[model samples]
Target: MLFEDPVFASRMLSLLTLSIHAIFATLGVGLPLMIIIAHWLGIKKNDEHYLLMARRWARGFVVLVAVGVVTGTAIALQLALLWPNFMEMAGHVIALPLFMEVFAFFFEAIFLGIYLYTWNRFDDQRKHLLLLIPVAIGATMSAFFITTVNGFMNAPTGFQIIGGQMTGVSPIEAMFNPATPTKAAHVISTAFMTSAFVLAALAAYRLLKGAQHVYYKKALHLMMVVGLIFAIATAVIGDFAGKYLAKHQPEKLAAAEWHFETMEGAPLVLFGILDDEQNVRFGLEIPYALSILAHNHPQAEVIGLNEFPQEWHPPLFIHYLFDLMVIIGVWLVLFSFVYWWGMRRKWTIVTSRWFRRLIVASGPLAMLAIQAGWWMTEFGRQPWILRGVMTVEEAATQSPYVGHLFFFFLALYLILVIGVVVVLRNINQRFPLEQDLAHEGGERPWIT
Candidate 1:
């Protein structure tokens, strides 16, 4: 990275920071809702399995929340430190949401601490369950507020530049930028989808390891149900994302589809290689798909990369990132459908060891899909750090220590990851299922 162009090195380091932070951020936002729902079900159904399930999830989440706090803090600082110029402008118009997110984070942290220690402290289960609502709301609002800043970047509104200063600022308008709803909803749904699958993967691994207990079965069922619901929601919101891009950020939509020429009925190119001749080679083209994606009409005229100068054009390689994201989304949908069908039909194949292993694999694959979507979004905005308002070169910090800072943060993230794994493993070992089962006076390690 030191040998690379300074601007390019800074961009790569920012990408690394965001990529790592996203892992915990995704879980942090999604898991609170899951935990609360699981707890609610435990009381409603009078089921001890769900009661233990929720408790276990909550215990593991404490560690993740701490990691999220550290990474979240690191990212907040990195924005100002690495992109001083952009932050300078943003501090005037978009600062409201950024500041609001801190309050939201504190809200979440306070309730989470209360929720953890107060577990099983209430005779009225509903009273204890009520405590989780703020935790869930705070987690979601934290993501929402932060995404508003990003939405402002994509479609910068409620402010203007005059005499090299941002003027006419309206923080509310900027916070609710055109891209905010779609992007925020998309982020949230995918986070839920990814988190569900990750927990499902853990349950599947347990089931595959010959733990045929009803506890594991119940856990797997809950995660899969949640995964399937959010998977569908993610797909629906993704379509809205396409429409949003086509209308406001058409160049991004065009590049993702590899549509080079502006025309009606433009075919959507999937998995294509671009040649110097401006032709896409050896990839599938779904006729009129791009037009339909853009306008919900097959004959709608869609914008294309040809409309923009080559220098202004985003790198064509982001098309693959777009493709990877879509392909993984489709895979999760279909894979979940099969799991649903097999469960209904009582198919032995779905219960086979290989099928359970597939469930385990889906967890990481879902996370990768998330990574792909984010990369495509950031890369597609290339040349511009804030769309048309600012370029990356202008926004990057001129600090001489960017390389050193990158290494320090990189080492910190590595240590944090190792700590999370070791701590979670220890938690799991310390609170084995037999301890939970002992309270119920049920057969310990009983097979279903």
Candidate 2:
């Protein structure tokens, strides 16, 4: 029956598209900042390697941006087609932030083009670095606007819904809704951490293959340092996000924590398989830990799914995914500390083969954590598309052909994923080694 529902089909398709799009989206938000940093460092140290690394990173960023544009356009179209009713009602409020996002995208694109093109043309390093400031700001602003819109969906404000229609719309207020701060901060911090780990993983892979180039070493060091800082920051922000959810979306938080009965001093479920009876069949729980984490007191009251109607409960599986995300976050935080400790002690860990392997492994793990975190967020907001405003069944298109469309888009995404991998691999292979650069008589290599 679920599979027969067009609403379910539409939701699945949207989730698939978002998951695929998020990889590039995070990178788009983050890689530009890293490039800017690399460029700035290059200028400060007169290091051609940092500059070259920045240029190469820019090429990858461009490819991802192109793909992001396609996926982003598809998402926009899906919103209109699949959720026309929701769009018609709240389009005005949503459009405000999205329109701002478009400007941000254009600003990023313009500065990115200028920065990439003027690499060889600009003899002045300061001017070249200055161009990247807008690129970083624009990219971050783009994410901020988009996340603000999503935040509005989670915690809508600035409008009254009377007689099934939105009225008294104040787009500015909606843009700065209660949920925006925590949501935007969490997303932006994860973007930077994800991008840093990706670059660090690449450097580790090269080092593992016996590449002793200073470029790889420096890249690894820089990316890991950035990654560690953001990774730690994300953990702290994640706590604030949890507190926000506890206060604003207690039911969703309950499902995520697997609190089957409302109680004080709730234990934090670590791993669990929930049954149809609303019971966690098997799991580990840290007694009183969730209450302390969520409310800073062991005896603090924590709501449960049973407090709401059965139909209103978010999917229980979100608990597992949420736990997985937290586990990965903890691992990354610990790894970052170890890496930092080694760096302070003259970088002794770089010589360890096991550490290099772990670094190589962290890339996919970071990606997994990012995806899992999103899964917890989106899926935890189940039964409602706009949280207390409209249900997914009300928002989804009535057309029965959505299932076919889902399959089509799934296939399309598969092709796009393969194409991206192939293109990026070829680009990586084409990058000139440090030895090649040394023999080139100081000629700046062109990325194109």
Measured against the true structure, the TM-scores of the candidates, in listed sequence, are: 0.96, 0.96
Residue 57 error for model 1, in Å? Answer: 0.4
CA shift of 293, model 2, Å: 2.4
**What would the per-residue lDDT of candidate 1 be over residues 65-126, giving only the tens digit for each residue?**
89998998888888888889998987778778988999998998898888777764677878
> CA lDDT, every prediction?
0.87, 0.88
For model 1, the local distance difference test gives: 0.87
Candidate 2 residue 433 C-alpha distance from true site, Å: 2.0
Worst 10 residues of 2 by lDDT: 434-443
N/CA/C clash count, model 1: 0
Give lDDT tens digits, candidate 2, residues 384-446.
889999988888899988888998999999999999999999887776575446643366666
Best by lDDT: 2
Candidate 2 Cα errors over 4 Å, as ranges: 1-4, 275-282, 346-350, 439-441
Residue 22's lDDT within candidate 2 is 90
In terms of TM-score, how similar is model 1 to the real structure?
Answer: 0.96
